[model samples]
Target: MATKNVLIVLSSHDLLGSTGRPTGWYLPEFAHPYYVLAPHVKLTIASPKGGHAPLDPGSVEAFKADPESVEFVQTKSALWENTEKLSTFLGRAKEFDAIFYPGGHGPMYDLATDPDSIALIREFWEAGKIVSTVCHGAAALTHATLSDGSYLVADTPVTGFANAEEDAIDFSQYMPFMLETELNKISGGKYEKAAEDWASHVVVAKEDRLLTGQNPGSARDLAVVILEKLNA
Candidate 1:
């Protein structure tokens, strides 16, 4: 079997919706998946503008004790140091076997509305490649329209950072849009949640080539699911 190449897209937006707080890719969301998938597949990181993808300060501080997070931050991995612009890889979607997006409040500001991001996702889906995102990263699915002119996520079972979770964190008001509410309204799919906030909850829309995780806690599970689907 050939080695599977996975593209990981991160958000370039660094501000947290006028809160005057800084934000970027969630540390755990990217680290957990990177370690889980790195040993088995080739991983490439990209962002809207390229260069060093900003790190969410809170995420770094929160997971600072975790060795994986520590290693990610300390190592000068080329993936994070030299991110390619999403626009430059638009026509090369076929070169990858799967694409993953890691969550942070930042995705809500940029990846969610980036034309190239949405187009690349649609292209990967249309070509039968696996597409996955976790937490607010699900926002990236918001504007994806299929060739038939229907929302790519329409009627597909998916999960993302729930509104209740947002409420728990007390940051919903600062968000440009409610992640869960928007996902439900746009996808028209059954959006399920865990009984407790921050618990692992993942939904795989088998027929849609889509996989989504409910929050940062579900990051590893989401990566495992993608690996299973790819290996099967």
Candidate 2:
């Protein structure tokens, strides 16, 4: 079997919606998947602006004691230090077997509508490759229209950072748009959440080749599932 090549896209937008707070790719969302895929596949990280994908400070401080998150911050600087621009991979979706988006509030402001990002998702989906994300990363899927003019997640069960979770953090107002709400609209009301708030929730729309995780707690588990799908 050939090695699976995956592309990980991060957000370059660091502002938390005019609140003057900073935000970027959430650490656990990226780290968990990184470690899971490191030993088993070829991975590449990219961002909209192409260099120094920012890490949400809140995540770094929040997951400060998590061994995986901490170790990632301490040792994986090189992985995200210089990413290829998303535009660079525009028509090259077949070069990779899959594409994953690690969420942070930043994507709400940028990746959600980036033409190249949207185009790439359509390209990958059309190629029958896996397309995945966790939490607010679903922003990247909100506007992706397929060649047939269908929203990629339409009618597919999917999960993302829930509105209730946003309410818990008191961040809903600062978000450009509600992640869960938008996903529901795109999925034709097929969006769902874990039974309890913040618990792990992953929705694998196998027929559509799409996978999504509900929140930070769901990141690692989602990666495991992705590995299984790739290995199978």
TM-score per model over all chains: 0.96, 0.98
The TM-score measured for candidate 2 stands at 0.98
lDDT tens digits, residue span 4-81, model 2: 999999999989988889999999999998999899999999999998999999999999999999999999998888
Off by over 4 Å in 2: 206-208
Best by TM-score: 2
The 10 consecutive residues of candidate 2 with the worst lDDT sum are 202-211
What's the true lDDT of residue 40 in model 1? 96
lDDT of each: 0.90, 0.93
Q: Roughly what TM-score does model 1 have, to 2 decimal places?
A: 0.96
lDDT of 2: 0.93
Give stretches of model 1 more than 4 Å off.
none
Candidate 1 residues 50-111, lDDT tens each?
99888899998999899988898888456666898889888787899899999999999999
